[model samples]
Target chain A: MYANRQWVLAQRPAGEPDLDCFELRETDTDAPTDGELLVETRYLSVDPYMRGRMSEQESYAEPWAVGEPLEGGIVGEVVETESDAYDIGDLVTGQGTWGEYSLLAAADVAPVDPSVAPPEAYLGILGMPGRTAYFGLLEVGDPAPGDTVVVSGAAGAVGSVVGQIAKLNGCHVVGFAGTDEKTRWLTEDLGFDAAINYKTTDDYQAALADAAPDGVDVYYDNVGGPITDAVFTQLNLDATVAVCGQIAHYNAESVPTGPRKLPQLIAPRATVQGLLVGDFATRFEVATEQLSEWVAAGKLTHRESIVEGLSNAPEAFLGLFAGDNIGKQVVQVAAE
Target chain B: MYANRQWVLAQRPAGEPDLDCFELRETDTDAPTDGELLVETRYLSVDPYMRGRMSEQESYAEPWAVGEPLEGGIVGEVVETESDAYDIGDLVTGQGTWGEYSLLAAADVAPVDPSVAPPEAYLGILGMPGRTAYFGLLEVGDPAPGDTVVVSGAAGAVGSVVGQIAKLNGCHVVGFAGTDEKTRWLTEDLGFDAAINYKTTDDYQAALADAAPDGVDVYYDNVGGPITDAVFTQLNLDATVAVCGQIAHYNAESVPTGPRKLPQLIAPRATVQGLLVGDFATRFEVATEQLSEWVAAGKLTHRESIVEGLSNAPEAFLGLFAGDNIGKQVVQVAAE
Candidate 1:
């Protein structure tokens, strides 16, 4: 038996969710049963998509009910196992509860190797965010060589990797970050051709025009708002926009309004397609292997903004909306 | 030489164009020079797309300059020719001037058979509108069997044919038309599964929900505004939207604002693609042959609201915005 600390949804948020919406509670966990493994949480992922789950609005992910335990992607150490798929002391990553201990089904979790990269890498560049940037940009965006690839929320987990992958594809990669430091990191550390500090930039369209004189051939949108509106205006003929996320309007109490973009699309004959990484589940191994190779070769770099302690998970999540994280935001529940 | 009566753009429109924007002028046509053919105009097609050309705003089609003679699709008889490709009395169609007579390049026109359908039919279902519907729906929308196809401006030149094509492909089709009569024409005459009279319906979303209970699998948007907003909410997973036109906002003086739709796309992972018939110019022969076959076999039907005389061409064009005409709207310059 283990004494577990879990986070529960105290109430549904009307707009921007605060720490008050979360409730930390103490619970007890039983030993692993058949096909189950007892995992001691090492890292808990906090993503922008979680904002949708906090409300009752219909979304790709199911909404979390009030008073129910919160759930998310977790990388943990297996203390006990009833399945042959995993052994004691093995590290695994899967969708698990935001608690100190989680009894996860063996099939739901996949074993991770710490030798190649740290266990938390399974939560960021080597996990869902990595796979998302891979398929969404390559398959959906379809960036060709010499194409100008633009990414919104480019300093974050998914956007940072998207710019790097596009660069590796011989594209002129440009990104949008909230801070000047993050923008510098994108162009300097990540090899991006250009990075715009969206927070300080008065006119996004002008900035983008200067950055991409040939116009944007591919747009991987992680943030949707005025930035996306500006991007739409500069789409080249037959441009492809991969709608990966709309973190900008995720907390709106009502449907937000923006400039009508359908008219802008007509002139360029552009394609705007929404995507969820789960749709590419069948080919995840392909992404995982390629991403691993890139990381090992030092071709792709990553950063993490880790908040210590399980009690800080809510704060870490709330930080995403404020653009406080430079890369993947994860909570450290216990020592690795 | 032949006396010609032509419509010229008197001024650029500020909003919905009034008749003052057009000026009828008297001109004279000389003999065909080199490869040019002197043709007598028979039918002048007035379409929703023309609204885009009246404004200086950037669009797929180039804008018309003030004091310049207007031009559009014209089916005419060759009175004189200098090239071996065509001869006198050859009934043909291509882009020609809005005048009683036009001197066209031999390479610019294609010969049309009056026996296949009427000469005016070349201006409607057998021409640009027909080809627009064919490729936009089949290629861009990519409708599948049993798909619930929803069309806005369903009674227009392109959209009416789009609904019929979806039906031919074994799909359940729903349409949004302006009037009860238009809705009746869709459901009763055109074999649409359901039709909503958007002008009379107070709640478009509710009306669509009742009509398309399973949600929209394919959307061919011809009209943009609230009708499109309502359809966005009902998109099924992996749905495809072929943006053929946005007649509703063509006359707007400034960029219009609407409910942000990128967020709605996430759950369904829908694709919204803009299309221009010119992009599929290489395969127009394939579409023309298929459309003619469907029309001949009685599987397809079309209607044209013809306005007599070239003098009424401006009136015919203006009537499109008011929804005064049904199906294809054309001006008859002279008797066949």
Candidate 2:
């Protein structure tokens, strides 16, 4: 077995993380034991939620201890297995360490079909991000047909899918993305009724008003900050805001404050709900089947900005805050 | 038969409303038209919602025109009836002008049985406040057994009932109120598990944390602002926040700003839903029956801060902002 190289949290970041926060280290590979599978990493995911783990503060997720290897969604191939469930050639995806190799329990990883889709897809469109967009939008946002569905971070992994799903459901979909290019992709490619370039616009509320003329019925929020504050202004009566991720405030030095929204909510009779993908684990198979069907029908298009190599994983993660990725941010460790 | 004395919005206030904002006028009483009922106002409700109507700025409720007679919840006895639904001496409640005599359509008013409860109880316990507490708590808050339920404006109309209902449903109830007497009333009279006098406490978050040691499971938010912000800090995973009113921000000159709470909601997967009592009008019969049963059985106790005379109605409505009235604020326009 080759020596496993991994990225470990060297220091807890004060605000936005730099390269110094992560230490690329060479560690001895642990052999597969009974009931475990030694998987060689192929593709690793870099999501916004991982940023919360980098901090020392207590969040919904247990804070990752400093000096420990960063663990995330990883798509890997079964190299050597000591369990009865898998063979040497099966590709699996699960929560794993950001390394070349990880010793995981047999049940921890689910065997994925590369024939139905690409192996890297399990890290993006067909995986955590896909499920997050699905449940958070359909279950929490609860958009009805002909309703206006607005999504912040509309080009990111989850938000992109949320827009597409809302469009498919016969809703008037409006998207707020960071770039003009992302906005075009939303309107031209993804069937969104309107797209707002939030970075270019001085007044997001005005831009959103132009897009969602009927007002926002469902808001699937991935980027929370001023953009969300603007979205709150245009909420229709009985609006549902599904808080998927707050990527904007994830790296703040302290909990930041802005315009109070509680008052705004009362008049509209709106609903805002926080969501995590892990909570929908039980219904994953159902969501995956629906997501897979949409993908197969050419209705759902996915984009992945795969940064080549494990060493660039931290850089790719840091790039998310800069809006560097078009869709999913994945680290390609090795080709299957 | 007599000159109808009514209150009109004389001027829109810049900050806190004053007695000058209201002007008492003697208006001619309208005789009952065919299919209409002439009702003499007996018990008038002065609620926080009325404060929103006085403002020129558009809100959920229609703003009161400068010269028009103010309209609100009025329980009156039918003096003369041209409609088959109502008879003379029958107590009916509906939206009516602040004048002693009002011409109402039969469909506009509902016959309220004072024999089951009291004439004033219909304007208090089994009224809008009762229905507001019922739907906002059960439908929006969704408190579970052993869950910690926290309510702001605990001594007021809706809040006092929220704590009691939550307590009755087998939840640990914590309340926050402006005065020690109100807080004591919450614990001693209404069966709240703990009550914090927010006026005396410097750190409301700490006080709330102490009261809700297991963390807040459901928050029935009546007075939104810093109190709601403190509740957000102690929210359990999947907690629910029912936003009934923002009495704190109703009088603000502009849309007010405070510590942003959208970021805090992400981790806990909490839900904050804005509520308007009228939305649940379809199910109000069920709610009113439950509330009435509780009131009749002596399980529910209602205290009315009745301001005698219709001339003082404007002052009573303004008093809501000053935290002057406790429980349901009502104006006794005439004796039943």
Top candidate (TM-score): 1
Q: After superposition, how far is residue A161 of candidate 2 from its true place, in Å?
A: 1.2
Worst 10 residues of 1 chain A by lDDT: A51-60
Q: Per-residue lDDT tens digits of candidate 1, residues B1-336?
A: 888888999998888999999999998889999999999999989998988888887677888888878989999999999989998999999998888988899999988987778888898889999999999999999899999999988888898899999999999999999999899999989999999998899999999999999999999999899999999999999999899899889888888999999988878999999999999999999999999999988898788889999989989999998887778888999897
Q: What is the lDDT of residue B43 in candidate 1?
A: 94
lDDT of 2: 0.89
Q: Candidate 1 docking: what grade? A: high
Model 1: CA > 4 A from native: none
**Structure candidate 2, residue pairs in collision:** none
Give the interface-residue alpha carbon RMSD of model 1.
0.8
What global local distance difference test value does model 1 have?
A: 0.93
> What lDDT score belongs to each candidate, Candidate 1 first?
0.93, 0.89
On residues B73-181, what C-alpha lDDT tens digit does candidate 2 reach at each position?
8899999999988899999998898888888999889879876777777777788898999999998898889999999999999999898889889999999999888
